[model samples]
Target chain A: MLIPFIFISACGADNANESEWRTLDLNNTVLLTLPQGKVVIELAPQFSPKHVEQFSSLVQKSFYDGTKFYRVIDGFVAQGGPKDGSEQDKSVPLLAMEGQFSTDGKAPFTLVQRDDLFAKKTGFKEGFAVATNNSKSGWLTHCPGVLAMARSNEADSASSHFYFVIGQAPRYLDKIMTIFGRVVYGMNHIQAIQRTTVIDGEYAVDSREHTPIISMKLMADVPKKDRIIIEVENTESASFAERLVKRRARASEFFYKKPPPVLDVCQVPIRSRLVKLQD
Target chain B: MLIPFIFISACGADNANESEWRTLDLNNTVLLTLPQGKVVIELAPQFSPKHVEQFSSLVQKSFYDGTKFYRVIDGFVAQGGPKDGSEQDKSVPLLAMEGQFSTDGKAPFTLVQRDDLFAKKTGFKEGFAVATNNSKSGWLTHCPGVLAMARSNEADSASSHFYFVIGQAPRYLDKIMTIFGRVVYGMNHIQAIQRTTVIDGEYAVDSREHTPIISMKLMADVPKKDRIIIEVENTESASFAERLVKRRARASEFFYKKPPPVLDVCQVPIRSRLVKLQD
Candidate 1:
């Protein structure tokens, strides 16, 4: 229940030169500061287009300005986008549900082939989780801190009632939902909300789980000095690959047992580091 | 994100009868009552030998009689352990960590291998997690509600202070840690705990996050009829497999768009029913 320790080894490999890092454009960045910590999200317009568009519009309109994180799962993810205060206050009609799984589980001899819902999967690529087949049709994946649209039976239901994936990859919903962006920094902030209510029997959708975002805006709208520099763990870099391999196999002496063979994309972590960058 | 509504075309099937149902004896059940609702966990002894053995012994001794579900993560998991409330609480020196990841990312092939403190990947079989290769031998995995030993640098440092997997699978820690048992039920109770503390700049020897579990006890120790009755979603059943596959693909019209192309073992849900069987 607690990620009490974020064991950061003395990798000591970070470049002291700031120019090496990139500053996320405010236009694409969403700062989510909750009780546990602060989380910044970088929307992926390339993946869920309509959702991204909707999110961008919401940011501009300040729709999430005073909303609460509302939900958080330790070691999982903290989610925001719901209005704060009370659920009794009805603002807009529930958002219409849209966005469908874009990938085709064509790979033969796999878990999906054996299961119906898993016939397909979703994952992150270049920070944008997309569901792709050899056909190249994809959507955003639901990794930790990924911002997504909350919908119902009707399509186009994303009206900022969003959620973040918290615990174990709920891949059963893969290819069946829409993911918009990921938390580029401060996911811990989202991991500390209190419970509120239950939705069906699933994790009761609680409003008290997390503190509201207070306000949300595209980094472009914030002052330039407020911008924070961040670096994505180069999943392609040798260091990144080594970390991945190590994560997949555990480099710690603590491991006397091993896990199953293959690594699923959803289980992989696309980490981002926060730093102060100045040219 | 909302889970797609699963419209059971039940063929209006005769719901399920005795042959289709398996009742958990109060004597064998662990009763966890939460503020919102109660959850019942069906223990799997095949996976965690030491922890299970310890848990059973403690249950017999009424170890967790008044323990509170101290930690709760929305999507991740809530963990309840550590004999709380005693003026002077001493740590329970648990056995050494078990389960080894394969040396070549092979044996536990089902386990999504990663790079960390060890070497290898393994997968899930029979609902428990294990990893292995030519040179190592052991068992342990991270499944939602999995009771695991919370240890320091020394592999044997785990004490009564334990943890659980609440949200999306964090398989990165597999095999590197020791998994004791899983929450067959009462997840909501644990998931409802308020994470009042924010980890600041990290703490060691397992700091603030190691909240206390008020107390716990096996139902058998309670009054005869006062005991709780629970049922686990039979994983070995055809219905369970059907649910997993059917839920995964989102083949129904409901899934206008899906997220990923795969599913992990932790996301596999196990339903609980509160019905008693006459002795």
Candidate 2:
């Protein structure tokens, strides 16, 4: 039972408290309170400005306070925000889906410099797992913990509903969905959300297992004393680059043979931590 | 509400019923009846002969009939076996870890021909995700749905406990753990297993929420009439190679631009179906 744990524990301990972690901005973050724990999401406004703006407004307005994770597919995604057939966002304008950013050589880049199967140039930019053509546009990828708007069949039908990727990185969703933010902390809480068992192709959720969102709010809306501060490893830092290399070909006592030489950007871990603010 | 669903369904429908699926061997498969549904696992003797043999013997002896999935990490693994910690295999000698296989030029190979970051060469041989150095040895990969043995800190400490990968491919565990089989069907049931909520760092599982295994039995042990036949896409078939290419650069109505021109073997869809037997 402890086999992989011991191996992972050793690999995870090296940079547990590295000083290179960059504190996130409260104004640009959202906090989701669940029965289990608190999940902090660092909003990505750089990639999808409209979607981020709408999401923050919805959060501030408490639009998602009591909504249940209506549809959760295990090894796939946990979706929420105004249950099915809900009328909470009827007045809200349907926002056009924003999936990619103009790459036209103007966007800031943190080159992962690896061959990616999903994008021509893959790396982190503005605190999001990003991929680009390296010339025209880039987009926030559908990696685990990514936050994206849930819409109907129409490309511009996205409104209040959103989902978080809680399973394998569904990269095919890239350039197709509007990824506005990502859960930075409490991934366990996201993983702990109840899963609906699919009978045939439809999933049935029991009300007893429904883990409702206690509240959703922008961190900025909360008082300074009550706000929880989080810091993420700066993707552009040299330490981050070194971490990527180490992850590609990890050589520990447990590993008699080294792993392959290539790495996908999604495999590059972005470590985050909770900390107390200095008075 | 339908954002990712619309995006995924279109991508999933193209090859839903292609005539490229290969039927699995009932003799080498195990059926795990869960509350959600029946999960069928195909044992891989070619990859980990000792582990698979031991596992089958234990299953036939009813060692895991009443065991609960004691440790389940969301987006990771569901580990289960004899929770009583009782000695079920006292008579059987503890088997040595069989993590990798001889990758010498003489070994059978099915080349994926992709630049994988985890292995020098990766492919499927005898119905398992395999990775190797191309000259020395290969091991089963930690792709989702893979079943592997669990052990202590010691490299040779594995015994009866086993786990299944239910989320993202934990490729880092490739050579560190012994992968003996893979879930050929009912993956949705595996994903629906209860998740332990980690409060702080400790996981808490509720007795009522715990999903117990109804029973475990090998398909060979059951009557032929009760057997469920599953056919997976042959990895070495021409159709599979063509599917891999289509997955890399899909250009459909949903996909405004062509996807990146690279495909991870893990991303390639291995289509499976339940076909009626020819009378």
Candidate 3:
């Protein structure tokens, strides 16, 4: 009889002290309501200021309401925006890609692994999976639940359309796409979104079968009484570093044969919880 | 406008010659029928012979019919088997864990990357993602769609319960669990299966909410007229190696900034397609 062990202990019990947890900035958080459930996304202005600004602006104006996830590929990404471009504000200029940025060595980086397959160093920065080159340039990794701007062949083409990674970490897209946020809650809802069928080597483009986004609103704009509070483990906190160390060591008694003492940056869990507001 | 490009080119066009695609062995292939769709799995007898034999025997006896995916954790694994142990045959003795094998240096291997975070070397063998230590001991990597046996605290306790990797590659379980097969087709269906919500850091244990398995049958037991043909690219084939090289180089014009040449073995696509039988 399998005991149903918590496979990835990263998402396990909330053992960290309250001080180690940081409540999400309501202004930077987006409440994306889908037909299934609400997905809470935390925008990363430090890495992708223009993208975050544009996305927040679009959300405030209800541009994403009733938009369908036009392109949802299993094991890749779920892209959603105005399907017919009728709802999009064409006047808003397409922003140049904010894919990667030079990081000062002092930036709060809790290292997860060195010599990553996609980058020289991999870790968590401000609750987002991050990869860096020679401790200089850093970009958000395409881990599951990452929010990135989708673009065409041109590097600077991204504007309103964005995607959420719904499957494996597509490291190949790490530096190529502009990632601006991560899902703090309701990742299961993102995974539950209907996927587009691929026929004859191409994704089915039928918008009718796709999942629809009911509406997207900045948490700051939502009424406090109706808002769902989300708090994530501060990646820079000492307790978080201890969690990473414990994961790497795999010191649990459940393992009959302990695996190698190494962990993928994407596998590191940044824990989040929904808090009920007091009366 | 986002071009909606084939993000993971591994699942893209069937450009390989007919000879490069190997038809699955009917005896080793299992056809799992879900209400949503059908999933085709290829059993790796070369690795875990006893586990495969037990699974195939159970499948032929209709042991997996009506079994529920009791423990489905998003971004981890989908576990399934006799929930109440009513259909399971208790006469069969519990088998020792066959988690890894000693591979001779002559074993056909198509290397994807060396110095993998979890393993010394990572590659593909017999159309399955694999990792090996010093080219001696080899085990199947727990990439998405891999079929592995689940057990309790004791490593050798695995009997009939098994799991499918549903999300990111959980490399930590590479050598700790017995991996006997992989999903060759219909991974989308597997991903689409209903997920058990985790309330307060614990997966919901109510089996009623889990997705039920309609039936599981060995392809060999099915009538020829009803069997679906599945062909996977032979990892050892030259064309397959060429495809890997092209992927590593990522010389596509679509890449504005070419990512690192390194490729994760789990990311390497072993293409499979369903073929209609000629009337």
* Each model's DockQ score: 0.19, 0.19, 0.37
Tens digit per residue, CA lDDT, model 1, A1-279: 134232232133423222322445567777654544556788766556667777787778777776765555443445566544345224534443334434444331112111122324333345454444434354454555667776666565446677777655454454455677777665544544554433223454544444666667776776667755566654334454455556656556655445444455655546555565322
Selected candidate, larger TM-score, 2 vs 3: 3
- Model 1 reproduced share of reference interface contacts: 0.28
For residues B147-208, what per-residue lDDT tens digits would candidate 1 score against the true structure?
Answer: 67666667666656566666555555676666755666555455545453332222222334
How much is A263 displaced in model 2, in angstroms?
3.3
List the candidates' TM-scores in order: 0.62, 0.72, 0.88
RMSD of candidate 1 to the truth, in angstroms, is 11.3
Candidate 2 docking class: incorrect
Shift in Å, residue B166, candidate 2 = 3.4
Of 2 and 3, the candidate ranking higher by DockQ:
3
Winner on TM-score between 1 and 3 is 3
Better of 1 and 3 by DockQ: 3
RMSD of each: 11.3, 10.3, 8.9
lDDT tens readout by residue for model 2, B79-198: 987754466634445668888888666644556645556666777775677877766777888888899998766678788888998766878777778999998777767876777644
Which portions of model 3 show Cα errors greater than 4 Å? A1-18, A84-91, A197-205, A277-279, B1-18, B84-92, B197-206, B223-226, B277-279
Q: Write the per-residue lDDT of candidate 2 for residues A1-279, one digit (tens) a residue.
A: 699988777667744334466778888899889997788899888778999898888888898898888788666788887756656758577998798888766745677755555667788875688988667788888888888988776778888888888766888788878998888777767876777644332335676687799998898898788777888887766677777766666756666555455656665657776674322
What CAPRI grade goes to candidate 1?
Answer: incorrect
